[model samples]
Target: MTAHSRDTPQFYLTAPSPCPYLKGQFERKVFTHLVGENAAHLNDLLTHGGFRRSQTIAYRPACESCRACVSVRVRVDDFVWTKAFRRNRAINADLVGADVGANPTSEQYSLFRAYLDHRHSDGGMADMTVLDYASMVEDSHVRTRLTEYRRRGPDTAINGRGAGPLHAVALVDRLSDGLSLVYSFYDPEQRDRGLGTHVILDHVQRAKALGLPYLYLGYWVSGSNKMDYKRRFRPQEHLSPIGWTLLND
Candidate 1:
């Protein structure tokens, strides 16, 4: 009999399912559990290899017929600040994000529920209950944090914390090279504010401030309208057969 070390990751494959991003296409994934002491290091390596962390599992697309999912990471040092991105920043100038522990709350759950209901009602996570949402935020083996965005308060400048109602939330992982955005949700009613784009922009600044070289944005599926916004963050790297290739266009 042979014993496997808890830190030794073993890969598994999921049964094919309907692709969420594209119509009439099936999707499959190869995954490994990130557990024990080496989880964070393993996560960083796998992320560089194009895997995404969901809970304690790191997975990447392995569809037999499609190769549209491309891993993308923004080059924090050379990030482009376009007119639209500047406008988005200005629009969210009154808001601030405070890093909090990866613990789920009723308030966060309410906003998450509303976001799913309004933005992705037909998606896979639409039926997620509070317990499921809690697991999503807290069931992680590596270093993770939750950034809660809210309107600026009087003490924001002094304390660097926000106040009032929650506007958005970002679940992020701290990797060796960069920050990987696991999930994010925002108030759907505040569409004009472009909270989604604002969140990404904020993460770019945060990563740069922390001296991290990249900000992993997960997989960008070509021809998926849901992923088109990712391309706007210029000077990004796309994982390819050879390695991480620069993508300026």
Candidate 2:
């Protein structure tokens, strides 16, 4: 018998389920638990191999007939800042993001509930309770951080921290190569603020400042309207069977 250490990750496949991105299709996933000391290092390797972390599990699409899910990462150093991107930054100029430990709070849950209620009422996470939300944020074994976005305070210039009510929240994982945006939510009522776009833009700048080469944005399903926004971030690389390929257009 092979001497397999408990830390050695064992991958499993999930039963097929109805596909969320496309109609009349099913989705399956191959996943492994990201626990123990090697979790962070394993996460980096798996992420590079097109896996995404959700809590303590890293999973990738393993559908038999479909290959629509493509892993994407924005090239932080070569990001294209268009006029619209600049405009979005201006719109969210008053907001400041502060990174804190991965601890779930009631305020965050409220915003999360609102976001799901308004945007994803029929989604899998639509009925997530407070406990479920906490597990999502706190159950991670890898390096995870939560960035809360709020209005700039009087001492914002000096402290670089936000004040006032929470506008948005992003749960991110700090990886060896770059930051992976695990999940994010915002106040749905403030649609004009473009909080979602701002979060991605802010992370892009943050990744560049930190000298990271990529900002992993999870999977991008082609032909899905919900994922169309990801295509706007030009100068990005999509993971293919051949390897990461740049997409300028």
Candidate 3:
């Protein structure tokens, strides 16, 4: 038997379970633990290879008969802003995002719970307690940041952090090539402000400012109402068997 280095990731396959995005279908995943000194580099490679990070695990869908979950990354330079996007941006212009450390706070937990209760009541993470949420944010071996969004106030620029109640939050990892958005939540009642859309727009601009080329938006599953919003961000590249290909329409 060939010996493997301790740093070499050992992949595992999950048993088939009901698909989260698609109805009447099952899903499987090929995953590996991101740990040790090589974790960050491994995460980068796996992300580039269409895997997503959850805590310290990097995983990608490996269903036997379905290929519904398509990995997508927005080309920051080539992004085309439309009328609706502009309107949404204008609506959220009062928001200021602070790129803070990945230390979970009680305020963040409160917002997370509110978001889950209002938005994802029946989803997998609906019952996650404050500690579970903390683990999700703090138990990562890769470079991560929690971008806290709040309504801009007089002291926002001076302190480099927003003031007042938190409006939205984005948990992201900084990569050599781009910013991968791990998870995000917002004040559900402020749907009219399009907080969700604004978060992506803000990240697109942030990526451009940081000289990053892509903004990874996790997986886009077709026919899933929950994932339909991802289609609006255009000039994105979809990962396929051949490689990442441009999606114009």
Candidate 4:
């Protein structure tokens, strides 16, 4: 039997838990393991159907009475830069990004720890140890990559890499259609650079260059202040029961 035929994935649901995005609401998830040779194929299919991957698992919110989480993807060819986006790009121009394989490093762990402590101290991943961080990067069975961003050194013109300390990092998955930004973190003190917005814009450019049509931004939870920024990527699509439709917001 082919890998896909032999290893059909079985879905499971998580017990209801306090919703992180909305207070006083509970959240449940339907998930399946993405493993074996066909993991990448399965991931692409599930992601297109509104699932988000975390390590080896693909999951989506399955709340009992709420449908707040909506899957979003940018329409790359139609993504025009607003004045604010141009400003963010100009502010972060000094930085250069290098796409590398999924390998864990001590330096990455240090940055991850600092980012969590500074930004998400009260969140679920705040207490992740070095091991947990490593698993987050290297445990994936499908195609995965890490992009490291840093200040361009004088020799960058020839060497094509940056120097000094790392400023940002993005853990992404290569899907058949576009890049899936799994997680990202940066120097919290450098929020003035607008690194978060810069990273997504960079991915959009990368997707266009690669002839991809979309850049998956995971789920946008309506009414969640933390996710409001995602809605700004205009001319995008939202996964609906019928199909992926243009989100005319």
Error of 2 at 72 (Å): 0.3
Error of 1 at 118 (Å): 0.2
Clashes in predicted model 2:
0
Q: Give model 3 RMSD, 1 decimal.
A: 1.2
Report the lDDT tens digits of candidate 3 across residue range 1-249: 999776899999999999988999999999999998999999999999999999999999999999889999999998989999999889888889998889899999999999999988999999999999999999999999999998888998799787899999999999999999999999998879989899999999999999999999999998899998898898899998999999967
- Which prediction has more favorable lDDT, 3 or 4? 3
Shift of residue 241 alpha carbon in model 4, Å: 1.0
User: What pairs collide in candidate 3?
Assistant: none
After superposition, the stretches of candidate 1 with alpha carbons farther than 4 Å from their true spots are none
Residue-level error in angstroms, candidate 3, position 26: 0.4
Give the TM-score comparing model 3 with the true structure, all chains together: 0.97
Which portions of model 4 miss their true places by more than 4 Å?
1-6
Pairs that clash in candidate 4: none
lDDT score of residue 151 within candidate 3? 83
- lDDT of model 1 at position 5: 99
Q: Against the correct fold, how does model 2 do in TM-score?
A: 0.97
lDDT per residue for candidate 2 within 51-73, as digits (tens), equals 99999999999999999999999
- Candidate 4 structure quality by residue, lDDT tens digits, 111-148: 99999999999999998999999999999999999988
lDDT of each: 0.95, 0.94, 0.94, 0.93
Q: Give the Cα error of residue 121 in candidate 1, in Å.
A: 0.5
Q: What TM-score, over all chains together, does every model reach? A: 0.98, 0.97, 0.97, 0.96
